[model samples]
Target: MASRKPQTPARKSWWRTGSAWKRIALWTLIAGVGVGLIAMVALLTAVYSTRSSLPSYDELKSSPNGQMVRVHAADSTVLVSLGPSYGEWIKYDQIPQVMKDAIIAVEDRRFESHWGVDPLGLARAVRTGIANRGTGRRLQGASTITQQVARTIFLSNKYDFGRKMREAVLALAMERKFSKDQILELYLNKVYFGGGAYGIDAASRKFFGHPASSLSLAEAAVIAGLVKAPSHYSPTADAEAAVSRASVVLGVMAETGKISQATAAATDPRTVKLAPEPRQNSVRYFTDWALPQLETLIDETEAPLEVWTTLDLGMQRAADEAIRKNAPGDAQGALVSLDRDGAVRAMVGGKDYVASIYNRATQAVRQPGSAFKLFVYLSALEAGHKVDDIVVDEPVTINGWSPRNNSGRNSGQITIRTAFTYSINTIAAKLGQEVGFGTVADMARRFGITTPINTQPAMVLGTSNVRLIDMTRAFASVGQKGVAVTPYGITRVTANGNVIYQHEVDTSHVLVAPYVAAQMTDLLQTAVATGTGRAAQIGRPVAGKTGTTSSNKDGWFIGFSSGLTTGVWMGRDDAKVVPGLQGGTAPARAFAAFMTKAVAKRPVEQFETQVTLPEWQLEPEDNAYYTAPDNGMFVDADGNPLSEERQPRSDDSEEGAQGDEQLDQDWIDRMTGNRPPAPQPDPGRAPPPRDAARQPPQDRAPPRENPEGF
Candidate 1:
């Protein structure tokens, strides 16, 4: 009935009567518009949020990436790099034009015309992304140079809509503030070039062994092609892939009018030669020792830094070779050398840095063995003992501790110089008791021995562990005529030619008395010339001591010339005894090898010493008295005397002096020419003047008319 009533205009409610295709088209258009509005709203929200959260443009420009910290050798050559990036920051104009063109042609042809965001590139990227989505392929990226700079400076490397919006906004802002060249410069410097390099300069130097300013056209193309994926196209990693990428870059350069077709055709990627890989090797240990010092020298800065260190590449290499040649097989060792001013000239921390980075020269804590007797001897000298003072070398016991000589033979009665030359453990122990162990420990500390010391009788035997650096520094104090020195590596730190920090050496603090140092130097020189350290002679006047620990666990040779103070230690890292290793053996040989190369460029100079005590005479009454104990304790001058047996023996004080050469392999080697012969006396040389050793004791005047008392 209702249909009958509406029959006239049932006329078709526009829906049923209207064209079906038209109706469907209208709805489709409406739905598309609605979806577009939603997407537009979302994009607008993202842009606004990202813009609000972006860092200020000034902040971004100040430290776009991490600062580059370089470690330079003594000659101002780069030794190593320490930072998130390698190489240095360069200005836009410093960039080679060929490199710039290659980059522009391959990375972004419209780089000069875009406002940070290339519209055509974005469109092409969108089309490609949609087409690849169905094929499930990796989506391609279309980032302009400015966009890359923006991301490098401000945004993280996350793939998200929000981050991309922020990148675009920041890139637009960067375009507004910085010129295109400036943006390009920042991009080149901030981009990662693989192989742990960041920046065009680093990449250039890393791959070509030269600087970016020296890049050729073909080289520029090779580097330019690496920006897309540094490791993937690294010439060092894969030459074929790198050459293929470079060829593509050259073709693009031709197409973009950056290079002529003939030039592109003529260039061959195969002709490109990479540099030899650098061998940081042991030099890295020196740099590692130098890095922590920067914080104390300069305030932290966002700009790149150049730290000029005191490392001599030649000396370092020689030291490394010496260790390799002479060090006991499978045993670890270290070598440290310092100039007279305490500049660390060479430091080899270990046998191989690649195997272990632990810096034995600066960080290892081990017993100094008899090397520490130098300090004990110094204490005794300060306590009124002369180099000619006689001490009995016999078995002695102190607090249940009896010390024995390394060779199981005693000189009976030996002068302090002879005792030290032989490194007699018993005489050193008795001296420790005589001067007080606390005094010896304090003396060591004054000479820069920071390792903890136990003031026990065994302390004289070098039972206390010490660092090679400290030992070298202690010897350096003696070499510098008693002036204390803090061993330093970095001489100056600069940024853009402006000095951030310049080290000012302090040469005023005297750690030991000048007379004591001089006397010690004289005695040590005699030791090297005629004692256990004879193996260390390098055709020059060398003052040194040889130290061998119990059971040959550690061996040390610490010495000084007028030019350098060096210390060499050979031992097992695990503290296990190394068979057949002794201070007078491998360690002394290494010392000679190192000093030979170290002093090659230096003019020869002798030690300067002046005797301070002229009128002082060693009187018999001034000596203490000692007696042998029934416990078989021969409390002689070389042995620790009990409080009750501290009686002096005057009869055995004057003994026959032995020859300069001792009955040891070290001495035999020197005499038989098994090693390099000592410097020969020049023809018709002047008669040697009377030295302290030749001076007669003023108290021994013809037994003095004791004839009357008899």
Candidate 2:
């Protein structure tokens, strides 16, 4: 073969020829083009399949995401936003150029050059992600601004190859449908900037307390940096991280020629002023308590809602500060304040909401102790008992259980006013028996105490658990002049610009007769004025009661003044005793601290004057010496008997002994008909020399027997 025709120059094998190599390259290119065409066809087909499910462009323009539910205080202060909060949509012309430049530098420097997706960036991201796999490095994201717009408006946040293909397709389609500026405006308005804020406008106002048009270069950089990881770079959540990220943004801005290097270096990220955050997160407690009420007030809708609540932001701040300052280190405290009309003004569910979210003011059910005596005294007044009526505070047994005074020493004889003022448990127990436990429970229910009230003997001493809100509502009823109150938070709710709901006060329901309320007010006023609740006084008329459960596991002070009713409770969540804790101590002091500031702007209001009643007189034969069947003796020269035959005194003798001087004389006059004038000494005759027999009786020794209970 080698000898034949000199091998034809070995045929110059086509494989090694230059022209053959060029032909081979051409074929390789053609095959690669064919493969790319098939891939593009598959991608188009997949994108077309998802197109039908994508939201229409107009739909995306309407609302890219669900609207927020904004809760506002009574003064129009924005307290919280439940979802994505959006501000007024800003036009492209109104957007700050610096903001746009900063965002472009940090988010997408190639935004102007790319149609939608940056091919070079996509390739780099793929290579880096591949290299980073299994290297403990997070995979890089290659979403362009157009891609983010597509995702925010049309796609769910699911990570997969299918989503990526759909995103690319949508971005391409968006580029064809909208101009670059339109896409950027949409991006700036629809992107979430953390802190519940969405859009550049909301982010600007939220972080700088100004509109987007007012953003400075430094502030713009800070806001722009938030786009990558809103929560992680939130100026409020982490100021240092936010500033650091902002510095990176500034550097990139200079490098991209969007800003001068000198300008970038001159900008101080630390100097950017951020809006002041709430003093404490405890406002979340009020928001939590009010959110459920929102659900009940209106039908569910995706439309943005504005809930104007009755909360007083100033009072809320005061209440929060009071709780934090007064709540013992080892214990927690809660407070609920309401207007006389039953609108919630402020609520502190716990000293620290971050530590626990259980709303003790509305959720906890603990013994009210003497605080429950409010219903007992009100029931007595409704049953025709005078506040000045004498009732022996001696230990008394009811159904084999004896209830004693909180002092653990029985006061020999005191008016109902004195007994209530001192929080005498024995007197409360006696009144409970006299009025019938069923009547006491009914009275509690009538005054907005929704919690179940037991009719057992111990229940007379507040052994039953009750919520602070219910108790505050009950006291508000008294402050409302007997009108039954239902505590409400949201005063009005509006959606888009239409009023969806508005709270209406119903004063037609009466919890007690006006005169009965006046009588109860009189008793409560005395309690705070000079008795156990004295610590709750704020130099104005206050009517409240103090309660301390056995072992001091719970302490409470519930009071009302100047149309504001507040209840304070302190205790451990587990109901363990707090050493030295009592209603008269920290709880009452907290009440004073809160009410002092809460009522500072309000005019002083006096409780309704008590109605006059016939002087309570004891019948020597029927009431002077009554003995219980269980050997419990009660002796009172001026006590009224619990008998059907006993009748109001027909004669105005004014023969009953005078009450303590510490008692209000005007109140005593209202209870008793009128006191007779003292005998005048003869003008010329020396007053009879003071004699031991004529001297006032010495203070009676405290009863020897120590009571077994409060």
Q: Which stretches of candidate 1 lie over 4 Å from their true place?
A: 1-63, 86-279, 407-409, 609-710
Number of clashing pairs per prediction, in order: 7, 0
- Cα lDDT tens digits for candidate 1, 1-710: 45554455445577777898989998999999999999878766655565676565446545646568888899988887766645777778888888889998998899999988899989898899988887865445678888888777766665788778778877776676678987888877778777667788898898898888888988888899998898689887688889999999999999999999999999998898899764549998898788877766776546789889999999999999999899889799899999988899999999888666678999999887778888999899878898888777778887778765432345465577766665666778799898898999999998999989888777787777799999999988988888987899999988988998888899999877888888898778766765557678887678888776654567788998756999999999998867656676788889999998899788767666421111111222311111100011122223243343232221221111122212333443443233443343343674234455434444442111000000
- Give the clashing pairs for model 2: none
Residue 186 local lDDT, model 1: 80
Give every collision pair in model 1.
392-638, 625-646, 625-647, 625-648, 626-646, 626-647, 626-648
Candidate 1 lDDT trough over 10 residues, lowest sum: 701-710
Segments of candidate 2 deviating more than 4 angstroms: 1-65, 85-280, 406-409, 610-699, 702-710
Give me the candidate number with maximum lDDT: 2
